[model samples]
Target: MRLNSLVKPLLITGFMLAGTAQAAPDAREVLEASPVDDIVAQYPEMMSRGIQDGLKQSGQVPPMVADSIGFLVSNSFRAADIEQRVVANLEAALTPEQLEEVHGWYQTPVAGKIAEAEIAASAPAAWPEIRSRAEDLNKRYQGTAREKLFDRFDAASRATESAVDTTIAVQLGLGTAMAALSRDSVHHEKMRERLESQRPALRGMVGQQVYDGYLFTYRDISNQEMNLYLDFLESEAGRSFTRVVTNSVQQAVIEPVESIGARLAAFGNFGGE
Candidate 1:
């Protein structure tokens, strides 16, 4: 399946409904407004203001609201959709206790904190690796095939990031709810052990196999766009753009989201009810 085909309807719906007074903001809007605000508020140095049309920062005028909304919608929708598929895959491969253990990893304060810290520590290292890998792969392939591969990787990465972040949020937000369901240290520990025992199977749910599929599909249609981006990155113009996008996304986007997630988790209380 082409990424465009998968994303077009979502983009259209988001664009048509942007800023309309619907009964409840669609998931994308709620995501855009709340999380973006939370992010800005968390980092006063990076972001002097919140989402105004787009994400405003101290030095930079934000991107157009439509563009930011589209990016958020495409990334968010893809992530949520793919994660549901992952959950379905895990449901078939793992037991209930195992699944709850996976959930527990997200629910526990230490685990959640560790995961966030790891991602932050790893991102600087990871991006260069991703770029290098993509470049090498492109060199081995030619023409449309190469383009498709890059696009697929980019889309999958975005989706994966969104999915992971949302999972963290859900886990943290509903820690209280989950505690109400599970009681006693023995029970919780047992569930954790079951999940740990099934680690291979659970990892498969978010592993390279599924991610490769997402990348392959994206590359099929967006090869040209991917090539253009790569070329720019290889040039001065692209270098600047890359720095801005990377920095803004990390400082303005990821940091705030993780902070809010931590706060929500703290508010929920780590213990299961």
Candidate 2:
């Protein structure tokens, strides 16, 4: 997913918050029933443009070749079958009753609308406006009770998939991908040390991105609507589903890194003739 970590990792609650099981569903079934596909399916287009702009900034590749690689990379990264793995993991970690409840939320008219806004807001195009609006939202809601409630949701989201952890993980993912390309120079230990050195800047960058995304996701929805949504998330089943879903998505993010890195590293094999 490039370095963006496409899934927003909002309101994470582990199974510890959920009640005991009511027969777990198969992961695939849960995934098919969930809104995860709608949430994630928009990423490839956003990532393609991001990669294209990045390639242009580097000024190393011809336009045609850059576009070609951009196209290839976007599809390759996304077509990694990550969604199935994520849903499967969520199924394993959560109770069937919990999954059903979460699935029900995803099917609701409000959730569907919210998901559409989120899918749109998550694009790179929305970041600038989102950041600007986030400033306004923070100020507009200041000292109000709703603002306090917003803070709780934000806090939980941050705790579950923190900017620091996101930064570290992303830095590592990039380093590992680079390492796969450099057999001798990119050892795992050294890469970790180097990434650690870059943490402070990455941390700040991730924080801004996350803050903007939160505002963007809920922009059109009212505080009352948000309150209702948050109430659901705060429930026992909601918390449990969130925990598993967050873990599943995180695992899905990393599952393809090494394999894809190795393939990129093996480019010489394709042209040694």
Candidate 3:
């Protein structure tokens, strides 16, 4: 799929709703009250160490949750602006026939089933063993190895965030194209009318799917990576590498792989013609 096409729904709806008069929710409070706390609570290493705030994980003084929330909201808004153009182009290129396919793809039982299956398959069978190994490695390395590995994980996570932002930006561009390609004023009006008519249902469906997909991707990827990481943490050399190299490679190489894959897919479709 084109990058813009993948991002349109995520960026567009958020933008369209930006003008609403409702008071914006507090990002920090929301983050604190969110599943973030639950996840943090469940983190064996961090939780055991009383490091629920991410700052301590990196050996930094934890900032107020409000401050982190502010940063997150600012970043989100800025990213949305950059994504608008991508969405425009995406919408422009979406033929009616293609739109049907997109809708069908999202709605299919196959998509959800496959996603779930992949997630299940990605989970490690022995989380306790993995954790034990990590703990032993941490003891042997005096925590240095574990710290290094975590740094790498953080870097990779940031890179993933960047890719998602870029994808959304491309989608916004596509949306602009779509808006322009729309026929006469009447035709545009009709499209708007139709969108308005379907707004509630479309928003509910899209929002739920996007949120669920995000959670699934996050969990599956994290679990898969953690399994390998724990194994490494248990080994002396693996611990050293995690401390020195894991995060760097994840950020520098692994994260960009998706975007590169997307680019290659586009090129393949064009066939060098």
Candidate 4:
């Protein structure tokens, strides 16, 4: 009996140690294990869509000109470039333990399911359906636990913030292009100030879009699953993971956009052939 008792305690201790012995994942490994690659792959297209919408709102850009601008924006915001930035930023922002925690979370079954929905939502193909059903989805989920949960989840994931940042970046790109064509000064700082001034308004507008997207993407996921997902997102590691990834993506796209004036000038010379 004594031997069995001693063995039981030893086994418990060993298991505890094993649990604490999880290896810290490298940035690349963490990213590879998550839905980041697929998501990043869709970013160029997403940015292009945003740029096109912005162009349309201007009510002055010709359809062909807008298409050309969209093409440039899409090509410039490459997935590989964004991945590189993500890796670099994650390495800087996440501690080893945080990295391991994030990697572990991404390996969960719930994470995989959520990733699937997110990946589908981010694709250009899903945009039409999401838009068409936006009103219906909003009405269906209004005043529900799921709706409240999604609002919290969106805050945790910085969805609205990232969308706003992307919008600002697109605006910056457009401004640079126009400056190059008009031989006007590229007042980047002033442009950023103007964009920053509009952030509050942008946030309000984008928050609704983000919420609608959440309703559409997570329609298949049960409340329990969403709660589980939200629990993780609200966790320290998940918050860090989301913040780093979103900032990295924004920086990557913005960097390329900054240098796009020259390329855009060349494209314009060709009449956006």
Candidate 5:
């Protein structure tokens, strides 16, 4: 399949929506209003390409074939119905009062600027500057005030774990499909075990990605703008926002991704049968 064909179906498949909407200011409103899609539409595609190249490096697939397949699979995943599914997954997790508070925060000038920065950071063109800024920021973050910033950033974003979790899950899915095509003696359980074992190694890379992402995203943001964000994230309102997002993702994205890997493995099993 081509890139154009795969995007919507991929999202729908990834999330498996049932078209049911709940109350207002729910997960639906939260996801759409958040920088979720901007983040989603870009990163998974990049990861898929990396997975494809990595498979080629391991002699599991030819580079040309891997590129075509990876492109097809990743492009289709530009969040096919994912937002709706995420919205659907929330079940009054955020009280109306909390929702209102979070909504007000999102409307703030600082939030808008930060959102723009985050979305832009996902772009391929942003990598060089992002990396450079992250390096500089890491060096600068040794003192008390700056150490506090990294702590707040980690708490708000959960960037390292989120990145690692997401990468491993999607890589497993793509790896399963690749092993099938290459006729490798693949045991899904064993593959998962190996990947799980590599967590320590993967953490640093994912952490770095998240770190650069933060620096790049907030590169030109003013200290006041930064503090506004830091305050919100550290506040109860921020905690609620993060909780609901984590909950919705667990329901809509994470669980469904596990299903995708299983289904791909099942497909290989059926082929053997």
Candidate 6:
């Protein structure tokens, strides 16, 4: 064998090895590259805020009871646990090729900017601004092309559906807590049936709220970039990513609340009142 021939073969082998080494990222690495983890990391705080707000709106629960329930519910949904569940779901729900594509998209500049907007909107501080501007936003964008785009994006991303799911989950949690306080049994089936019957009305209400939120969050995002985002959301990997993240977060939020009643009941006399 000639020395030149051997050298050429060695070079080709090296290139092949390098290519193989650059394989698709694992679940955690994919998560790190995306904003999913950051968004999910805020779930516990969001859940807590929702519980407090719901209690306040009802204006029925005593402050001490409300506070105790809030503490118990908040402590139950840790960011770590939610993140772990999200990663696991991603690994299970997505194929290797889909995961690779999903990871690649999240690393793009457009994805980064979109993620920044989402994270900002998810923050506790952003709620006031979002609420204050929602009316003006709706008035300005209600019939525009951008609104249409937002509507499409919401449909592709199932934003309204996710909001509805989260709302129902919170309602179930509150019901469990109330039942516990009253020393009554919580029939989850009946509760779910009732909520299901109300789903249409809830969907209409949440859909509008979701639209308003999109207007506020993506106000600065150009239509071109949003179109790019919509493309991703409509893609196979994008769909898988949405399903995995939505399911994981819902499970994390919903599962913890099942025990909220028992936990609250442990407060004994205070829970009774």
Using TM-score as the measure, the top candidate is: 6
Per-residue lDDT of model 3, residues 123-234, tens digit only: 3333334344544444544544333444454343333434343333332322222333332123434644555575566555544333333333333334445545344334
TM-score of structure candidate 6? 0.88
What tens-digit string does per-residue lDDT give for candidate 6 at 32-105? Answer: 88887888878777777778777878875877767777787778888888889888989998998989998899
lDDT of 4: 0.84
Cα deviation at 99, candidate 5, in Å, is 0.8
- Candidate 6's C-alpha runs over 4 A off are 1-17, 183-186, 265-273
Instruction: Work out the TM-score per prediction.
Output: 0.26, 0.68, 0.22, 0.82, 0.73, 0.88
Instruction: Give the better candidate number (3 or 6) by lDDT.
Output: 6
lDDT of 5 by residue, 1-273 (tens): 789798989788656544333333655566667787676667456555555666687776678866765665565453645555555544356666777677778877788889888888777666667766777777765463544566578878666777687677766776776577556877777888999999999998787777657655775787667888888887876786776665555444445445555655567767887
Return the clash pairs for model 6, or none. none
Candidate 2 achieves a global lDDT of 0.61
Which regions of candidate 4 deviate over 4 angstroms?
1-22, 179-190, 262-273
Global lDDT of each candidate: 0.38, 0.61, 0.36, 0.84, 0.67, 0.83
> If the candidates were sorted by their lDDT against the true structure, best first, what order would they fall in?
4, 6, 5, 2, 1, 3
Q: Runs in model 2 with CA error above 4 Å?
A: 1-34, 47-69, 78-80, 124-150, 158-167, 176-186, 268-273
lDDT of 2 by residue, 183-211 (tens): 44667678788878877777667665665
* Candidate 4 worst ten-residue window by lDDT: 264-273
Q: Which is better, 3 or 6, measured by TM-score?
A: 6
The predictions' CA RMSDs to the true structure, in order, are: 23.7, 13.5, 25.6, 6.0, 13.1, 3.1
